[model samples]
Target: MAVVDHAPGSGHRTAGDPGGPGPRGLGRIGAVPPRRRIDPADGLAAVTAWRTASDGSPPPRPVLATAVRWTLAELADRYPGGACEVRVPPFGVVQCIPGPRHTRGTPPNVVETDADTWLALATGRTTWADAVATGRVSASGERADLSGLLPLE
Candidate 1:
């Protein structure tokens, strides 16, 4: 299973378990904390500013978080599948691409990266191949390549 900061707080203590690292340490077998719904429109403003900034600097934390989650949601909506799990820690995670869905344990296809890299990929600021070459992404499984569906601007 993926261990992401977006799942829950670091202290993963569960009732009836002392915590040893497993389902018990995770607070539940395969449960993730609910994500805070962010309106994409709100993020669009920040993204626009970020894209055109003279300094090429990122937006503030809240704004960046909004953008990351919105982009992840947009990707999920576009792909509409559970074959690949894309994760951006401290911000978002989404299941996308079309193929077989995993019912238990770690998914066969997974793509994990930081929010900055994800935003770059979601927008047209960077390419999948470039990010992969630069080691900005960790993609596993055949369906994890998202180049076809990116530049989602």
Candidate 2:
């Protein structure tokens, strides 16, 4: 599953892009979020809201953002390092895995995905292979694969 980089606002849409199955997201701009510590409790609450919204609608942006950041933070703690960069855009980004840390330019290993896909994968609702196969995730460079470390239970 190789996804090439596209310019910002390139209008590139994956099979089940940011909005996922339904009209989940109106539209979104992908960007790195500021670094912050998100309590796992807050994160879990937001994720729960996203998963059990009943209306089949996504949680509010900030709430969803919290979920994204919390999972990313958890991942970082699990595999502490600067080897890989995981991006769930317009929400959060985190450096993770154990490998050579990039001191300049972009990190070699990078994983990028929409908030919906990220939420699904992060919480075990979806698997890494499935997301890649469906083009719901973009991964590049060595060490980018996060198949072994996911579904943050």
Candidate 3:
């Protein structure tokens, strides 16, 4: 799972766990803890917003961030256990699939792409083979191909 820094002094948030606590025990204080994972429903909302943008204009950073994070998190949530690491730079990374777990050094299975490509693939805007053929994605290891599980839309 991807690990990200949440609010200051708050505990780290793993990609698959959205209900984790926030800074200084905020959840214990009855405050809503910061979201660590993307809720599938919320992800759908983000996707809708993006798809409805006028003239193909890109949504704001927050919207894109939400969509990207949610999709990636949802992927992690669906595929429990760590066998492959998927990376969307400047947005998030998630460990998924089910097989031998990688602990250190270069992971055996890895998939990487820019945020746009990842979003496109996740939303069915592009195919895994097209992304790979066009050099928009870099995948390594036997289990790194996610064509079967893509278009999470």
Candidate 4:
């Protein structure tokens, strides 16, 4: 398990520590809280904010990165198996769709796309077929078709 320590005088509670500042009455002294997991809602918020921006400009790198990571991670969680490798370069990759697991070498099923294209597909701004037709996505293998699992919203 990973741990996170609050700074001194931060008044945060630590697990199993008495007399702390938080509701649990645990003090920050020598506290080793578990590391926070990435929240998918946070990532979705980032993407939504970028998509709804009035200026119609591309999202900042950090926001885009967060959105991509969240969506891909969500897919992995939902599918819960490593039969397909989904790749969005420079952002995130996850193995999903239940079938044969690839432990070595390139996976039999692979899908690759740029961050923008992925974000578009994930947010329902674009469809998988349209993206493929426009040459925005490159997919291989029998299970590479993610049309049924896209627009993760």
lDDT of 3 by residue, 1-153 (tens): 865568754666533454454443455455554558667688888877877762388888788888889989888877866789999988888899999999778899999998788888988888999999999999999999999989885
Tens digits of lDDT, candidate 1, 45-133: 76766566525765678777777888898899888999999999988788988889986789999999998888889888889999999
Best by TM-score: 2
lDDT of 1 at 150: 91
What does candidate 2's lDDT look like per residue over 86-150, in tens digits?
Answer: 99889888889888998678789999999889988988889999999999999998899999998
lDDT score at residue 29, model 2, on the 0-100 scale: 43
Every candidate's lDDT? 0.81, 0.83, 0.82, 0.83
> Which is the winner by TM-score between candidate 2 and candidate 4?
2
Number of residue pairs clashing in candidate 4, backbone atoms closer than 3 angstroms, sequence gap of 3 or more or interchain: 3
Count of clashing pairs, candidate 1: 0
Show where candidate 3 strays beyond 4 Å. 1-35
Superposition error at 107 for model 4 (Å): 0.7
RMSD of each: 9.0, 15.2, 9.3, 8.6
- Give the total clashing residue pairs for model 2: 0
Scored by Cα lDDT, where does model 3 land? 0.82
The local lDDT score (0 to 100) that residue 49 gets in candidate 2 is 88
Question: Which regions of candidate 4 fall more than 4 Å away from where they truly are?
Answer: 1-36, 53-55
